[model samples]
Target: MNDFGSLLSQPVAQLGASIFTLGHVLAVTLIGLALVIAIPVMAMRRAARAQAQIAEEAASRARLAEERMAEIMRAQAEMQGRIGTIAEVFGSRQAELTKALSERLDGMTSRLGHSITEQTKSTHENLAKLQERLAVIDTAQNNIQSLAGQVVQLQHILSNKQTRGAFGQSRMEAIVADGLPHGAYEFQATLSNGNRPDCLVRMPNGAPDLVIDAKFPLESFNAIRAAAEEGGPEAQKIAAQAFRRDIEVHIKAIADKYLITGETQETAFMFVPSESIFAEIHENFEALVQRAHRARIVIVSPSLLMLSIQVIQAVLKDARMREQAHLIQGEVSRLMEDVGRLDERVRKLQGHFLQANRDIDLILTSSEKVTRRGAKIEALELGEPAPTAPESRATATDTAAHGRLRLHVVEDGE
Candidate 1:
């Protein structure tokens, strides 16, 4: 404290180190003047530029912020809408579930009657409806059982030889089930010569197709069946060889009937539905198939028929793919034409935008000219309006519309 007082008592210590000598003081004063005037002048200009940049950045950020806020509000609104929608769905589901219990569901559906009878209350009010539903269930159960019995009866009928022929007809359906859509395949088709082949396999070439005829020689088969019904082995050996002879004769009969000129191909097909019959022929009488082959008659099994169907399917697919390839080439050409038209439209649109910008610039220049005139008027006194004329003004709203419709009036000089 004593040292501070001594230091404080001196004028040079209190103020600074001393103004010192006159030349030293003058040099320090000059440096201070340079810092105060020149440095501040340069800094002030830089600060003004920085302030302007800050204002522009603030304006840009404000615009971006507004856009983000708008997007957020829209998202919030959409979310609220979705929440309302979900609430409605849940309310409806709850209402339905509640009604499912409270509502007396009576005879709404005959199909649902059984479930209702089992689940409903046993009260007197529900008893009549329940009894009605029970009656319906009884009737339906009986009908179903009867229908099942009928189905069994039908199956037994099909086990007979006459009904077995009908089985082969629906087996034709298995061939139709091949991917060869209905257009390519024909069934029970008649030949050109008044002969109806059982089924015809149309060739890839639309001419001279092969014919397949189903000939179930069931008479001999019936004889065999009868022999089995009676007992077995007693009579079939003599009649079995006779049955095999009948099969060979049937093959020859088909060749004789259908192998006419312009009617059937020399090499024709005889369709056999049962593989057991096929196996029996080849196992016992191996020469029969070979003899049929010698007659230019092929005995085709169901497996062979399905294979034929697949071959037709391949043909149909090939035809379709080839057609699609041609169509793709046509579509490519049409797409290129569309692209060219789109480019032309884009060029025209650019020209229109450029002309519109020029028109806007004309309006801006007219505005600047009016501002200059306004500034000139502000410098003059209000009493000096008598010496000066009013400044010219033009605005888009004030422009006179010159558009007029032309009408030609024909006058007759009578």
Candidate 2:
């Protein structure tokens, strides 16, 4: 029995030791669980504080945003009111600008219409003027055609020698007739040598007549011109020589026929109808001109001949004036004598007028005396006393004196 009781005691001690170790394990586990719970609670409390701080900060930021939005809204309202006022002002200004532009456009439209009307009128006037000018141009063209025909006829005439001579003669005659009076010049007049010159201008005071010959050497001159234009130099030289010979021959013939010692002027004119031919001769043929001058043959162009005729006309007029000088002087003397006689007659008439004036004054005085006497006779009444003898005698004496004065005035008037 003792052994068994010892074994139970050993097991019971072992069980107690195991229970103690279990208690320590339990205590350590409780501490660990408390610590874990406390740590979680603390973490939860800190998260709550952080959430409240975040909420407060969010509310402050939202208030600030609200304040900014309110300010923005007020500014927007004010801007809208300003925009409305600006729109009203812009509308009024736009209306004024539109009205001004309309008035300006109307004025411009009226001006444009008036300008167009003026331009149309001016265009019509210009067209009329242009038409008139065109008509004038047509008339001028017709005239030019007629002149061309006349020029052709003249060329034909100049081609023939006889017709050319006649043309020159007619031209010379026309110049002479136009410059000198009728009866002063004679055409185809016969000289003392029985040769009929083209013209003879009569000189005053029995002077010798002046002679003019109109025939020219035109054929050779024309040949020279043609050869110069169309032929070689040799032909031109030959033509010039022939022309010179022809001119010399014509000059000699004219000088022989027209120059007479006592019948014609000492110098006779050989008229060249063409001034160009005269100028050519003078410019190129100095020797020929000298020879003609020595022969007393004056080569003259149409203008020179006209000038000579005018000089002759002046000389004739001067001679006529000289011839009438004595008659004019005699008439002047007679006029002076008539003037003297008229002056003497006027003096005698003045004397007669003065005598008549004196006689009229005496007549007026006698009339006045007679008028006073009649007044006195009328004033006497039928019942009045008669005049005294002395008054009657004085009145009769006054009447007799008045009658004597009246007779004296009448005799003086006669």
The prediction achieving the highest TM-score against the true structure is 2
* C-alpha RMSD for every candidate: 34.1, 52.9
lDDT of 2 at 236: 91
Residue clash pairs of candidate 1: none
Residue 173 CA displacement from its true place in model 1, Å: 4.4
Can you write out model 1's per-residue Cα lDDT over 1-414, one digit (the tens) per residue?
877555545343223654444445556789999888998889999988877776666556556555655664565566557655765675676567447523422332332454345333333334454455456556555644544454454345434454333336566554543334545556677766666767666554444556776666766767876776785696877668778888888888878767776545668877777767667777877788899999888876665655565565556455544454455445545545545554555565556556556755764575566556545544544322232332111111112211110111111111
lDDT of 2 at 267: 93
The local distance difference test score of each candidate is 0.58, 0.70
lDDT for 402 (candidate 2): 53
Ten consecutive residues with minimal summed lDDT in candidate 1? 405-414
Best candidate per lDDT, number? 2
**Model 2 residue pairs with clashes:** none
Q: What TM-score fits each model? A: 0.38, 0.44
Per-residue lDDT over 218-285 for candidate 2, one digit per residue giving the tens place of the 0 to 100 score: 88889989998999999999998998998899889888888887888899899888878899999998
